[model samples]
Target: MFDLDLWREIFQSINKNKTRALLSGFTVAFAIMLFTILFGIANGLENTFEKFFIRTAENAITVRFGTTSKPYKGLKIGRQVRPSNKDLDYLEKEFGEDIQYMSPKISRNYQVSYKKQKGGYTVTGVAPDYQYIEKAEIKNGRFLSLKDVNNKEKICVIGRLVEEDLYLKESAVGKYIDLEGVQYKVVGVYSDGGGDSQERVIYLPYTTIQRLYLGKDDIGDISLTYNPNLTVDQALALVEEMTIKLKNRFDVAPNDQRGVRIGNQVLTAKKRLDNISSGLGALIPIIGFGTLIAGILGISNIMIFIVKERTKEIGIRKALGASPKSIVSIILLESILITTITGYLGLLIGVGILESIGSSLERYFITDPSVSSSLLFSATIVLIIAGTIAGFVPAKKASKIKPIIALRNG
Candidate 1:
């Protein structure tokens, strides 16, 4: 089906108006290129959120109690909402099977000092289950054991920051560090790096903090893991129910004292990504369509003018027994050939630029971004259709002109 003459004419016409054609084709390519990059960046962000949240148990809900600003139900304003061991025990008994992992957190900013070398770091109270639920990575030794918690052992897990500060000159495992005059054995070192959901935390046992320091048994927060495949409505309802039940058991206002906060606010990060991805998904088509229309219009206009300039030649071809379909097919093939070649080139350049700039741009906000082949294929298909249609109308009009009239006009 490939005609050598038709291809020769397509190349000749494009070569004749090289600058104009190149500029027009570049327009079409630019539109698709922008869409492709945006789509990839959006998917990357969604992936980042997925990696951060989806690796753990599906229905994982975290509980945090912060100070309430207002006095509710005859209570003082700015009341601190602290969670106790009783609330942890109660939730465990209540949500038993529905929950997969239940871990309590006790976090505070402290200066972990080993005499001369001291640095500010976060001290977290965590148990063995914290590793599974939060996905903590240990570089050496091991995390706090059940025995550590049960026996109130004065052993701590150091973070990378602590390692750099306390034993930066040496290995952190089996090192001793001070927590405000309390000396604890460094049993492990965790390498979590840093993330939006997770921070650099040095973990110790809850009982160790309470029994060793003669402090209260108040836990900072609670982490509950559930199935994540549930719907947004289902997740919200479950957390809402759990929060009410917890408040009632503690005889505190759900909005105030004995207060507890439930639900993964970071799960709502999915909302942010979904918004961008869906919006960009929709926008890509609009831009592609717009560029397609412009390309079609340009090719149609140029072909109509070319036919007008070649009225005498068209008249001679008609008189020489050229069929209407032949005339139209000739023009359409030229248009399509030009568009297909230039459009592909533009796509390559655009994709190259995107690949080049992607990592550099992602550091600020977007994560790893890359385009999909399906989307590019779809764009190419659209360009081909536009080119064919643009040529068809003009070519058909040229074919209908009478030999006598075209000859006279020329």
Candidate 2:
């Protein structure tokens, strides 16, 4: 595989017209580099979408109570329909098998203070399943357990921003913080990757908030995830059916969408993902193929010029009993060497740039830019094919050169 003499001959040919070779190689390299970076950007865009929707499960559906806009079954219009724990119990009884995960959220705004560090923070009461819904990360201690919910523990999970505001450099876990006038022991410090705004919240057991803040039967909102295996159409159908059932239970008209606000994050995310997938599917090939064709054309043009310039040399070799096949192989080897080297360099530089940028792009919603191995492999195949064709056409033309004509022309 290591042909020293062949390489020397190729190098000699390249050095004879270094400017032209360099220019042709630059074209191929630039094309590959652009392709690599564009592909990485596409991947980054997809990652950003994944992170944007990470606050809930991909197939999660959230329901919030709203006022009845249309009167139904003798109920007056403009009546508020409030969902409570009784509704959760009813849903569990009616559709337990279909529900994957469920949680209730009740929020209150209170001034939290600890040793003169006082600020208004939104206190949220949630079930244990709420952790999954939030994708909450525990930096210290532990998240609330089901035992804490059942026992109505006065323990809370503070966010990173809360911890910073209340405790400063000290750890928040095991410390007591005053929520309004009530004292709650911090059991954990959590972060949801939602920035400072989301960090300005605390999580407590829903039952605790229900019993003390609101009535024991009160619930502000419900979050549930259905079967993940369901198709987008099926999932939306389920959401519609559940909305109707909820409206009917509260005596709101079925046609009144405002009576029950349904947040089908699954459907929303699925539709967005579908659009992204389709968009990338149509976009990447066009750009990649177009650049590749240009690169191939550049290589073909350069090879043709090289063939014309070397006509006398090719004629001399043929006059000395060299076969057309050897001339073809020589030309092909030179083309492949130029294309492969340039393309490899371009790929290396492109990937190096992406890797160096690292997670800094995440702030702009572009996280972990990367190219797939299959894409690189495909590009390599394209290079090989293009190199062969670029060489083949010129090599064929060079082989047909008559010694008498070539010598006379030279």
Candidate 3:
């Protein structure tokens, strides 16, 4: 129902008490604005964390060798612990079901040249499965094959930036690149999510690298992805068991941490998720309390004051035969209108601020900071409902006032 006369009365009251209306509106607006911005920043922090972790395979585990920190059996402390191809085979044979993809890496920096365009870049020798473990996308041809590894062929896969640097917009596939005076044909070009540093590199068959560089089967590290179906706890348990077995195999002390270091992505991701969940859990209540205080205390106090100030006018209206419903309607509608409009205004302002400054906050680990549309809508509805309830209490009292008593009190 359209009620022009009722709305006119409500508008007149608001216009007359502009300061009071503005003050009441300000409290709700400020609370909602703070709520929106805080949530936006929290979401951005989550985005940053996700981006950091997505650079590598989610199930990846890396084993790196270091000098033994403690003596075991007849071996002395400070003995260098090196892994070899035999260890890779042993892992496959022992826990083949738990493994998904495995690769042995032997990395060295070499002066690479393609027709006079020369650059110093990392050259890594890896098995065919290294592509999946590294999450490398084949842009041109194909990655290292099983035949390449078996034959010890001098074929290589170059990163996207490596191709760009040396080939100058031309494809690196089917071309020969000189690596420290040894010519290796480019079999493929790859792109990685890990950014430019990961892209400025080259990959070759592990056997070829062993024969050409070390003249042995020694590898620098082992990288593998565990079965994706394994739970986090199961993955962790697998790593622990594998660690103990490797230590025993090498005759190192059971508790020697440096002899064989295993890095598990599952453990790292769990810790990160726990931290983020805890932070968000703590934050949500504080923001809720702030908005609650604005609604229950701020709006209630102001509505009470407005009713007290208008006692005489309420009495006059009652004396002039105005109904109790009309009095209640005027005050309640005024509260709802102010709260709804101001809450939405605050939401818009908060979103605008995030849009303008989100890019600059990257250093602070906040990315794409903004609130969801549904969340903004929900906040506004809550404010409106709060305002309606707050107004109802005072409006009910005002309606029950005796005209004579109200006049005398005024």
lDDT of 1 by residue, 259-325 (tens): 5667657556556666776776687557656765665666667666666776787788788998888
Residue 280, candidate 1: alpha-carbon lDDT: 65
Candidates 1 and 3, the one with greater TM-score: 3
Using lDDT as the measure, the top candidate is 3
Q: State the TM-score for model 3.
A: 0.81
Question: Which candidate gets the maximum TM-score versus the true structure?
Answer: 2
The 0-to-1 C-alpha lDDT of every candidate, in the order given, reads: 0.72, 0.84, 0.88
Give the Å error, residue 354, model 2.
7.5
TM-scores for all predictions: 0.70, 0.85, 0.81
Per-candidate alpha-carbon RMSD to the true structure: 5.4, 3.6, 3.7
Point out the higher-scoring one by TM-score: 1 or 2. Answer: 2
Candidate 2 deviant stretches above 4 angstroms:
1-5, 269-273, 297-305, 321-326, 348-374, 392-410
Q: Give the runs in model 3 whose Cα sits over 4 Å from its true position.
A: 1-8, 51-55, 66-71, 75-82, 93-100, 135-155, 173-176, 180-188, 211-216, 226-237, 255-258, 264-273, 352-369, 400-410
On residues 337-387, what C-alpha lDDT tens digit does candidate 2 reach at each position?
A: 888888888888889888988578888677888999789768966976787
Q: At residue 368, what lDDT does model 2 achieve?
A: 85
Better of 1 and 2 by lDDT: 2
Clashing pairs in 1: 58-226, 58-227, 58-228, 59-226, 59-227, 59-228, 60-225, 60-226
Over 263-296, each residue of candidate 3 has an lDDT whose tens digit, in order, gives: 9755767667757767776876577657656665
Q: Compare candidates 1 and 3 on lDDT and give the better one.
A: 3
